[model samples]
Target: MSMAGDGREPLPHGPDPEVNHSSIGSTSPERDPLTSLMEIRGSLMVFATVMASVTYRAGLNPPGGFWTDNIDGHKAGTPVFQDVYCTRYKIFHYFNTSSFMMSLFILLFAIKASINNSDITKIMLHLTVLMDVITLIVSYIVGAYEDFQSSTYALVLMLMVFIYLVLEATTLIVRLCKAIRQMAYVLAKI
Candidate 1:
């Protein structure tokens, strides 16, 4: 077979063994398996660290205090704490802290999946983290305002996050299965 000036050989009319298999340098250097895997893992780690820091801050510094103050002589009127101020602060603190922790855990799982090159697992982890953020925001808003409508929104967000977590877990399970299958296949071949 004669090679073209472009240094490329013409394709065979039938299936070729070389065509069916991959060569050492067929893939781009940037897309090298190890490099890609490491990049993904590094991204996941960064996300995890950010989330953990946020959660730690939120959890440690909750707002509002239940101090008793004297009012008008011996008689005291129990003025209900204003939701706009106290409630909002408390709600924000709770949501931020919870969101941070959830994001951290999800990021950890994402890193693990990236190490294995499991796209499905990484995507699921990201989705779960996104859901957590959504839920935290909704809950904080609901807590800030003493409105029935806002409460409903918070509940819906919570439900969505729960569902997403379950889905993410399922994806992780699938990734594990794939890993096991691959290992078995390799062993069998050997």
Candidate 2:
């Protein structure tokens, strides 16, 4: 029984209506199988993106891929398209690949920070999201302006990949934002 102000009588025994076993948003009744599947799909997409970017950046890719560098200590083999004069495609590829790899690092850090619920993780996650958007923009520009340096099929494929990456990154950003909001709600409740 709760303490009474006047000590006249004790309150009746009953379950607390406000009692909750889980934190705020931990028991979302709206979550369905489809949403769960989508979350898993998003995670897989992110993993695939990271893997693809890493493979290309590491130079373990097909000929004429992102690893077509020919400069000393740049890439082991000879240049893929013989365009080693550092044109738009070369510069774009370099920056785009570097950005992609850096994004992977930020994402991994963000994941760790999110798990720990650290304030710094929130900031890092925000930065990662912003970086993702920037990368998307840069990638699109590369596709639009630089893709023409190659054949029509290659350019179209490049644009398509960038579009998919942007869309996936956008969705992931929204999901993470929602997660942060839920964390905020839980903190406020506590």
Top of the candidates by TM-score:
1
Give TM-scores for every candidate, taking all chains together and pairing residue i with residue i: 0.41, 0.38
What do the candidate models score in CA lDDT, each in turn? 0.58, 0.53
What TM-score does candidate 1 reach?
0.41
The residue-by-residue lDDT of candidate 2 on 1-190, one tens digit each, is 5466866677557666677645344536644423433334456357536644753553344225444454555664544432443464455566556556666665455344224334444444544545554554454455344445565676667567767766766776677677789888999999
- Residue 130 of model 2, lDDT score: 52
Candidate 2 residue spans exceeding 4 A from truth:
1-23, 26-77, 80-85, 110-116, 143-190
| Residue pairs in clash, model 1 | none
Shift in Å, residue 184, candidate 1: 3.8
lDDT of 2 at 168: 65
